[model samples]
Target: MDTQDIARPRLSEEDWLAAAYEMLTESGVEAVKVMPLAKRLGVSRTSFYWHFTDREELLEAMVRRWEERNTGNLVARTEAYAENIAEAMFNLFDCWIDPDLFDARLDLAIRNWARNDSNLQAQLDQADTRREHAMTNMFLRFGYQKQDALIRARTMIYTQIGYISMQVHESKEYRISLMPGWIEVFTGSRPTQRDLDRFLARHG
Candidate 1:
């Protein structure tokens, strides 16, 4: 058999992006270079250009993924159906526990990356504003005054972002135990027994 006839592993754009995303969450954006990713994927460095034009393109794709997965899910969750504001909040809280709805690691990675990148920082600010607005609209939908809605939305978002930035660790059980108080504080109403039951069942 001729060595030239042997086939190298075929890699997809997602394969490259996934490797970059992992490096991003584990190390930092600086660690997400093409050579490192190619090495990690066991592919030729040239193979990267087949998917992305360059490192900058790959980085932008990562940002798009973060925006779509984290910010998109958050906005959708805020608009999820519920009988009242407190129940509505429980829907949003699911983002804290569900990685599908919110990739906290990616969010944190982007924040850290933005510290040294002004353009990315601008994008992050825009995303934060969008998320805050979604929460504010959620509150307004349930009859809160515009001023109160904005305040509560900022409070909820800032508190959650703080938890992510601080890398707070807590057991799911422990966090669930605190849900009622947190919900009441954010929504200005304690969840009814039914609301708590529904929320608990969703997690359970």
Candidate 2:
């Protein structure tokens, strides 16, 4: 029988990863124990072990995927945008910089876990650098010099991360929403009407 013709009832590797991701987001990394993971997937522990040798291995894969998900399609699309860069920046930051991006409880729990875990710290640093580099590249594409791009990229990311770090504590979004107007601080000053006119003339 053709594979498509038969009922395909088996769960996929993606399904397994999604379940693992949920466990990580809903609870903390500590909550993603081997038994709990198998239970979440409605699979035998044997089946789980067949796919992954242990929780540590699964966590390695999870962090790798998380890095890719963050700095891959999402950032790539943001940087490749042809439309309003400001709008793209806003939407992109909104996702990452939202405390609601994942469970607040989970976020706090993971933050604590990361402080003690070397692997987790390394993964976080890798993610941060990749994100910064991607944003820096985008700024460079917009005619910024390499030094200016690095400064601006670092400024943008730190500002967003700081906003979200507080967002989880405050359970509010208003402050970060007001960020764009603050962009002038990154620049020397607010753009003059003449400056805007000149910039548009060149880029138009």
Candidate 3:
């Protein structure tokens, strides 16, 4: 083999998936074909088959990643230990700002893709239910009535979804400035200075 052939590196499953994810995020699902991914990765298209059985499988894997990262982390955050309801609220809110805990871009991409696919839309609905249920239980643990917890949970999650859908952009400093008011609006109590300080430290 020539030196150029020896120098070429093989693409891994994650490499292919990462490329596909970029396409999905940038140009929507229709742009996530194997050929485009191969071109973007500078590898032969067959490399994708080494990891995924087919294009459908790749798409399914993307959805699974979304669920595991976004939904799973949100649920876990709702279950995190806190001294008070305000602290707990900030724990869950961390998902909105932390990319490691939540992928807002992937969430938006999946939601846009789901618009044309009933099956995907159903899955999206189920994920929303799961997140809302977790947050509702969180409020209930903090002494909210069942009905109150449920409505508050819905309002909190729906507002985040609305922000994603509208592609709203705000500076971190500006958003953080409003967290105190938003916490009161969602949880019926304003956070203490200590609670806000703790939350800011985490994000900062």
Candidate 4:
């Protein structure tokens, strides 16, 4: 009707979800309410209703997005083609360094949120299992025996989880410096210079 009204950008579903994700990362799920998110976006609270039916629906959508982007994408990358297990290790390492592929902030926030909700906790557990299985299959594809693949996969996945849970802060250089040794420990074979170079070209 007015110039100001016309000038206000029409909000999309993604805009509300993005704001909610920021709040969830900053202050956990309980802080992801409609009014606060609306205020954060500088839009009317009614705008959210057009995108989400209620706060619970918004929360579910956030969880679904997390699953699709983080867990689903990670598994897909892990299963990507590699000449050997060492190259496969590098493929999976991309997930750790690439925020677009795996968001540590969102992952940690959801884990924290799960501590208080049984339903969410179950969902998190399922996701963890799926990830572990995917990693195990990667090793299996590289000719590991079933038992060995399962153990190695558990070791790799759990170590990453520990890094996230402990909130370890280290420069990327320092972290990448440890990858060679870590890959050896997880896969039972040292990374070749070519493997190291490939990883560094992307991450270093």
lDDT of 3 by residue, 1-204 (tens): 334324578777898889988999999999999988977876667777779999999999999999999999999999999999999989988887788899989999999999999999999999999999999999999999999999999999889999898988888788888889999999988999999999999888
lDDT for 55 in candidate 3 is 94
Which candidate wins on TM-score?
Answer: 3
Write model 1 residue lDDT over 1-204, tens digit each, in one string: 223223565678898989999999999998999888878877668888878899999999999999999999999999999889888989998998788889889999999999999999999999999999999999999999999999999998889889999999999889988999999899778988999899999899
Best first by TM-score, ranked = 3, 1, 4, 2
Whole-structure CA lDDT of model 1: 0.90
Worst 10 residues of 1 by lDDT: 1-10
- Each prediction's TM-score versus the true structure: 0.94, 0.64, 0.95, 0.93
Candidates by lDDT, descending order: 3, 1, 4, 2
Scanning candidate 2 in windows of ten residues, the lowest lDDT window is 99-108
Candidate 3 residues lying further than 4 Å off, grouped into runs, are 1-7
| Candidate 2: residue pairs that collide | none
Q: Highest lDDT: which candidate?
A: 3
Candidate 3 global TM-score: 0.95
Candidate 2, residues 1-204, lDDT tens digits: the string is 334313444556676667877877776677878778767766655556646778788877876665555546446645654434454454454444443432333334455567779878776777678778887877677577999989988897777566446754432345443445554555334444443443335323
* Per-residue lDDT value at 162 in model 2: 68
Candidate 3 positional error at 32, Å: 0.6
